[model samples]
Target chain A: MLNPPEHQVAGHDARLGGLGPLADGSGRFFKPLQSCSRGDNELSFYTSFSSDPRVPPSVRRRFFPSFHGTQLLPASDSSGPKPHLVLQDLTSQFTRPSIIDFKIGSRTWPPSSPSDYIDKCFKKDRETTSLTLGFRVSGLQIHESGDAYYKPSRDEIRSYGHDDVRRIVRRFVSDSGLASAVYGGSDGILAQLLELKSWFEDQTIYHFYSASVMVMYDKEGVENGRSGPAVKLVDFAHVVEGDGVIDHNFLGGLCSLIKFVSEVLTDPDGEGEGRRMKAKKGGTENGK
Target chain B: MLNPPEHQVAGHDARLGGLGPLADGSGRFFKPLQSCSRGDNELSFYTSFSSDPRVPPSVRRRFFPSFHGTQLLPASDSSGPKPHLVLQDLTSQFTRPSIIDFKIGSRTWPPSSPSDYIDKCFKKDRETTSLTLGFRVSGLQIHESGDAYYKPSRDEIRSYGHDDVRRIVRRFVSDSGLASAVYGGSDGILAQLLELKSWFEDQTIYHFYSASVMVMYDKEGVENGRSGPAVKLVDFAHVVEGDGVIDHNFLGGLCSLIKFVSEVLTDPDGEGEGRRMKAKKGGTENGK
Candidate 1:
């Protein structure tokens, strides 16, 4: 049975209310809903594919719908502020070093299925595939009490497929690759890589603070259940502005910053420092 | 004794005119003197110890001296534009990767020597110490006509010192020790340790930059040197800046960027984005 009282899981499925009063085929809805989170509480937003017979298979949250709500921690608790996210990449042997968290304005979505696109693209077994893209937008909002707020909690992640996103990721990876080469086959290379990784991860998360959709890797579990390496693509998108395109106000330099960062990160050998670097053995290249 | 005029070794030095005026404690003289070089048509900026007697060096020129001239590159040669400086870390095995070259603005102390304090503090081994932080700073001239003009090649190199140079190096190493402790020692600790090393190297380089001192290290020879690792510090505090503190402007941000970059390049598992990441030997620390 599905979870009851949909509101309880609002953090998981945001579209629980479904399409409200569609005006016509033009894709405009007559009834609009608005929700706000408060400073005193933590907010979580989530969505899961539903199996309701009335909904179509192509849509995520078909039966259950997405949810959003604020979480109240015990007032007596001390530890300062609670970290927003805790993502554990099952493949990594090292422990989760820190929480992956960020604040956002508001969230909008399309909620469509895209097969195992994410896993296929980043496949490690030397599989060649076309690059796929995806995106999410979360809106920024001002609370009734005059506080500024961003949507979508830190834990929930969204991916984008736009050429911009692809270009950005590609550049980042390339820069990182050059950096790796410069470090050569030394232990120092590893340290450099770690700091870079932290920077990239942190920067990516920071973009989410505005209205940027994050990059996500599907956790390995389903196919064999026993768990191996394969990751599936999760269906989700975030909207910061009215449409999928982020307004300059919310995500002004985020895309460009992401691009610059990726370019810097991918070139490991210091090749991008106005020069091209040669690749090392076993350094595989993906993406056309 | 110091390789008089006509008998200079081929790769040792050269003399160029139009270096403007030379200033000393006594007075200013406008004379063209012969200079030395390790390579043909190469210029350098370096530091030296003023007090030491065996190499009891006299100030070659003032610290961070300025040269007022223009350099002309063929623009046809594929090597890109030649930098006003061709710096290297004589103490270390590898040359600095990022700073291949740079430009010297007007109002420079034409033929001042690099600071001697830098060399005294940076000891390579117990017995054989580097006399001066040797390097070349070529490509000198005065701009004439429009954007393009004939500039007399006035190339000179000198050395000077600062009391705080050694203290800065020690402080950097100390800070690195603290930073490494924060992230070292765990299952993949070896790998992590390597990462921290890169971070430290970058941080060290960055600190030097902020001090307005251009320090370079042999990337390839750090570990193989006579000391724990091979690195060199060159004092350019005397180089005259037309508008502001040129050394700090070039060194500060660069050092930070280099450190940040070096750390990223050394990442072992590529920032934990793949399937076999779980096979990383150590179990994941989910709670943290």
Candidate 2:
């Protein structure tokens, strides 16, 4: 049976409407195919990337969800049965997963996008910390070692400032007064992200606009030092071809994220005065 | 000013409705962005292929229309302005252009497509010459020297059998009393299709489902021998990733088409009885 994803921290929710992702118990996540261009773009991205030789196998296995083609299922809204892109559920193996979705890139919209879409993205980017910080913590749920769970509301997440974001990042890594093994060591989120960054540094194949970097870790498994962490790239509805040009916008945003995560590791407390990222105006073109 | 394309022999027309392609006076074809997946798929194909190094430069340049990004244009149906993918007009330079759009592949629908879509494509393929000949002339326009023109209607085109399609193909290449210089030379339609065949023989990049191979030549230009024939692959809305596998369905259909065209080159008249291609049953899988 299909059910609302228990661990989805960001994006649309099917419990609220018919247009969100559904989780099947059999380690599968079924994302409802949008009736618009967004759905087409996302599907196309997955299809092309699945077999692309330029993307290393290690990167493909570690940083991307396994695509299992598409299927038609009954709609949650009772509108009609629609197609869904079947993907591997990221949190399927976790008993208690602590997940955070970070919407990467300083600008979400491409230059070729329609004026109205550009305006919509521009307004949202300025309203959030995205325009300033290069990346924004869209949503997060920190599961403590105990039964305690900290899931921030949408408004609260949207209202986060640079300092607030820093505090949250520190909190996410901290469990029972000690740092979790999810963000540190040789094979952790930081290392995985750096690997992705390395790929992005030279990849001139695609410009991933409005894409997200999702980081998740099983708190219980982390306590046992078993599963560690998983960092995967998600969302490609607004992705565009790079056309033999490096995506500096995404690279810059990724670097900013790395800096923040690195700071959390080095300086857990807010004692040291870290350099603040300047709040830039306009779109990604100007940010670059 | 945006105008209806004068030389567009097939596909949707903006003059009929709001949801079709428009021709800019300045050597550009503006295909209106469909609000659905088809538009997105087509856009993604063009974007990826524009820079894909796997596709040889010669193949890219000669067999595909040049892409110039997209633009927002006022809708002909007065539904307000919307985005349109801008592409190089294939017949921009021709004074009296003769064109034929051949919907290639024995099975137009992919196996992964929805049941309804498969049924629709199946019915059409059976009704036309596609199921038997591996290709169907979707539409065509023959331009004779002076002011004579022969444009087949949609119904007439649809009703064409194997023999009728052969006659039309011969008629397209024949101008006045002599055979036109558009289908026999090294730089002709046959040679270009052969080049595409060589690429498809080993290419595992994409499976072009429901794609069309368009053949066009200028009647006046043929008379002067200044410009030769142009063979380009068009319509990529249903294109899917090949996943490191050869698209045998498309390759088989292409080979069948090569046989038909080759037969025409060797025996222009219907007197020399040609081998009839067996009409295959079922989808592309069965066709393969």
Per-model TM values vs. the true structure: 0.21, 0.48
lDDT of 1 by residue, A18-133 (tens): 32111222221121122233111112222122333422343322111233322222111232233221111222321111011111111111112133542342231112101111
DockQ of 1: 0.01
Docking class of 2: incorrect
Docking class of 1: incorrect
Fnat scores for every prediction: 0.00, 0.00
Single out the weakest 10-residue window by summed lDDT for candidate 1 chain B: B125-134
Cα lDDT for residue A128, candidate 2: 82
Residue A231 lDDT, candidate 2, scale 0-100: 93
DockQ of each: 0.01, 0.01
- The sequence of per-residue lDDT tens digits that candidate 1 reaches over residues B1-288 is 111122111112323322211222222111122234321211222322222232212121212222332243311222334323222213222232211111221112221225353234222211111111111222222122233322222222112111122122222223223213222223122233243323322221121121122222222232244222212223343433111001222221223223322332343322432222234325553211
Q: Per-residue lDDT tens digits of candidate 2, residues B1-288?
A: 888888888888777874688887679999887767988999999999999999999999998989998898887677888888899988887888888899886568765678798779967977887655557889888886576679879998999875677677767776533342567768777788888877875576788888998888886676787777899999989998854334545654565566556656777663443322222222222111
Error of 1 at B241 (Å): 22
Clashes of 1: 125
Model 2: per-residue Cα lDDT at residue A118: 73
Tens digits of per-residue lDDT, candidate 2, A55-83, equal 89988999989999999998777778899
